[model samples]
Target chain A: MSAPAKLPRWAELGLLPAVNLVAALLLSGVIIRLIGESPWAALKLLADGAFGSQEAVGYTLYYATNFIFTGLAVAVAYHAGLFNIGAEGQAYIGGLGTGLVCLWLGAWPFWVVLPLAILAGAVGGAAWAFIPGWLQARRGSHIVITTIMFNFIASAVMTWLLVNILIKPGQQSPESREFAANAFMPGLHTLLGKVGLAFTATPLNLAFLLALAASFLVWLLVWRTRWGYALRVAGQNPAAAVYAGILPPRVTIAAMLLSGALAGSLGLNELMGAQHRILLDFPGGAGFVGIAVALMGRNHPVGIFLAAVLFGALMQGGSQLSFDMPRVNRDMVVVIQGLVILFCGALENVARVPLAALLARLRGEKEAE
Target chain B: METYTLIVLLLAATIRVATPLLLAALAGLFSERSGVIALGLEGMMLGAAFAAAAASAVTGSVWLGLGAGIATAVALALLLAFAGVTHRGNQVVAGMAVNIMVAGLGPALALAWFNLGGQTPQLEGAGQRFLALTWPWADAARAAPFPGLLYAELLSGHNLVVYFAAALVPFSAWVLYRTRFGLRLRAVGENPSAVDTAGISVTRLRYQAVMISGVLCGVAGTYLSTAASAGFVRDMTAGKGYLALAALIFGKWRPYPTLGACLLFAFTDALATRLQGVALPLVGVIPVQFILALPYVLTVLLLAGFVGTAVAPKAIGAPYAKEK
Candidate 1:
């Protein structure tokens, strides 16, 4: 594969993302115009709904909390040179784990159950991902194909478990009963109010704090630890890593396991914190969205966090836009999100060409002078 | 139902369900054999399915519907070619982006055009929807017994699209292996630099491969909208493109084997459809989801090399770059 053109730090991190964002928004505007919607009105509505009030901001972060887990999951694997597209499946299984634990240990004290839920979530996600990792490392299966297949398997398993086994008697909906009291995550508003800061109630919960810790943990693992260095080394070049006495297969498994664990934590936010019940299709495409987040953020922990927030705003705001402008439906918001991903993930080079050329020209002129 | 009748029904259902997978796998075969991965086949198929349904509803012509579908898919194929061959972006990432883009665009456009919850108006009459072609004496089944009855009921009543999908397998196999273009195409995937040194345009070959892929996917989409059911629904492909990819890998990217894998997967699906709520000999009742998941689980097993090693094209995901 060709190495992406290396530009200055500002150009790489700042200029390119800015240019791509503008292009994506411009294209989205064109599509909106074609659909006969007022693009400007939609934009204003989106902004207001995302950030106009504390409650709105709280909801946005609530969504961001899930993205953060999936994004970090993606970024971790990305640094290790794995695509990890199975994050969606991993997260589903992870939620199943948490949901089961929450149901089984409903009567346990909060302190007794919380750690168990965390471990189950991590173990569940990691278990789902481990097969693909083992296959790629040991059996020569391509990670992309296997992981993609596992996603379907994961969906089927979740469907069967929820619809057939877990549904309450006489309940027609394919959902588990409301979770036990100990499983209820304290919402952000409540937690903040405990300290005296007035915050409105929203779905945002202590999981957001967990997400913050996860970001720091990712940063620490990727930048500050030897294990992370070996993993990154393995990704960059298997031959080089082997020469340096690193075991490539072991690194692959470790990276995938960690990535899956991070992704699985989404269950904690969406299930334990928000829905408080096992429901159908809870992952809701967040796992795939993580790919966009990772790509836009350049697979950095801080970058992933910011990108997650930006996407969270988009989702929260887009819903408001759809609500206010009847013409702009839910699909319209998806189109916008997809456009952003297309530009940022695949079409970034279109914007990069001119920017890189300009920067090279500037460098040449300075050297010549 | 009698045992014989159930067996016949399952076999018939298998062929019906296998058509889409066969078409999509063939489409993916073309793209992957020419050195490009096609994860975006899902998007292309979905776009075309929508276009075919919407156009047929408006035009009252199934042929025109099929044409619209192909055109839509070809346009997407061109975009993928642009991203992979020209821009040289990451292949899988570009594909995933295209998939997400179309997933959004299909329902959004459907909502705008039809206001029917991302579903097109049902294809209105005999002309708009492809009708099943019953062979002569197929209707004689009521008066006949055993062989003639089974033959008529099982073989005579599929839409013409199913036959076309089945025929394309051998056609693709011949075009992929027995033709001169096939020779060069195979070479390009393996060693584009060799083709480049031999003075063939690598980009053009890859583009051509992707175009064929698009047409095949378009046909698959048309069949979904016009033949399988009537009209387009959101996410109608339902990861069939990915399933086809799994089949391709299981087949080791070969056309004939690809057909076999598709058939196996389709059979499992047909079985799953029939198995739902049925009491088993040992287990009280099988969970339908587990049976529905059988294809993916099997695919994962095949991919993990449990069955055999699946070898892909050597330079499949790599962009063509001249050595400096």
Candidate 2:
């Protein structure tokens, strides 16, 4: 095989992702056309719907908050060489934690309930993720398979709990009672309104700020800490880590714990932040979206924030598009998500090879000049 | 007498329910045995289910639907091959992309074409579905007592796919252990370097395995839509592909053992359906959710070596770049 050409950092981080996004969008346009709609018109509507007004931006940010939590969750595990697909399940269990705290202490002040709720959510998510980590580390089972299994198990467990035990008395639907006003995560609009600043009410909440904080903490934990270095080393090369006296199994367990905790934070945004109660399927495929976010973001916190926002835009816009253009629905966004995964994750090198050649040619010209 | 009839009916229902899983497990057996992770089995099945249901609904021909399903699944498998075999990308990630893509694409396309909220129109005419075929002398044998119940209820009436699935286990066993192609396919999964040294193209063999798996998955999906139900429902596969994957691992990647695992899982599913609200005397009312989750729980335990160890193909999930 010939030696492969290399590209600069700008091309690596920026141009490559942009190329992939374009490829995904172009294909999405084809699907849109296949469904008998003009892709340009749809694109226009989508952009307008996502960013045309303050309310749209608020909803976009609201959705972005959930993506950030799950994206960080996935990124942490990816760094540890573990494919933790159990984020959906962990988020579900985490919501249960948040819900329990809120239901029991709904009468308490916001300050007292919020801290405990966050802690309970993290602990719940981490605990759920711990089993898969332990199994992979000690029992020789594949973490991917175990995590996928846990997602289903989580669904089943939640169903049983909700239907049999936790369903609000005399209610037919499988959901918990509403959390008290004190327990609700105040919406951003409401909070902003108190400061003499006016904004349209949306689901956007303080959890968006919480998501930003989580992203920064993850950056610190994954890049700045000694444990983070060990985790990265273990992920990149187990043999090298072992040679350097780092226990891979321990790192795997720790990474999963952190991943699960990050995923668990999703509930704070969706439940305490928006819905204000636990419900079935509240994760609503955000865990899977996190995979796409992490992949598109190249597993970086900064990249994740950008990718999460883009996806949030897609979510907000796609829903609006579906309302106007009945032919195109929210599933169109799912199709986009899948194409993004395909382009960014699976077929990542498709654009890289050609782009590398181009860069190598440019360098050759520069040398000759 | 009533209880005896119900037992026979339940056993028959078990066979019906097991068909799709058995086919899908065999499909995974082919792909994973060739060293490519078949996580996209769910996606392939879902895509084919929608294709089959749509074609059947449109053309009113079950055969066309079957053909369409196989073609769709083959196309998907080829995409998997391109990413996994040709590009040497992460097999798990690629497989998952296929799944997630189909999960959305199927529903989106369905809504666009049929406009029934991500569902195909109901298949009605006789030609649109694979109706159960009663065996010769089925009615004649129903007149007897025990023999009648066994022959007519337990063994006779089932769609063609169920019979094909039953016959497929022994056929798969023969092909795996007895055929030259099977040997090479298995060898490529175990050690592609050895296969490459022997002048066999690892890529071709892996692609062939994936294609075969895709066809089987297509049939499984077709069975779900055309035979098991009258129309395609959104997310109708409902993790059966995963269940089949679990069964594949539980069976230790062997044909007969995998069939047994499928049967066990199917029996549980049948039981879950029957015991949905009924309370038993000794066991009391078992949660249907627990029964539904049993297969996943058992597979995890099996993988953990709590019960027995399942050794995967050595070269599985690793991209083979030919040595210089």
Listed per model, the TM-scores of chain A against the true chain A are 0.97, 0.98
| Local accuracy of candidate 2 as per-residue lDDT tens digits, B34-68 | 99998999999999999999999999999999999
Best by DockQ: 1
Structure candidate 1, residue pairs in collision:
none
- In model 2, the runs with Cα more than 4 Å from the true position are A1-5
Quote the lDDT for A161 in model 1. 82
Off by over 4 Å in 1: A365-369
Pull out the clashing pairs in model 2: none
Q: Considering every candidate listed, which one attains the maximal lDDT?
A: 2
How does model 2 fare in lDDT?
Answer: 0.92
Q: What is the per-residue lDDT of model 2 for residues A268-326, given as tens digits with 9 covering 90 to 100?
A: 89999889888889999999999999999989999999999999999999999998899
lDDT of each: 0.88, 0.92
Model 1 backbone overlap count: 0
For residue A189, give model 1's deviation from the true position in Å.
0.3
For model 1 chain A, give the 10-residue run with minimal summed lDDT: A1-10
Quote the lDDT for B68 in model 2: 96
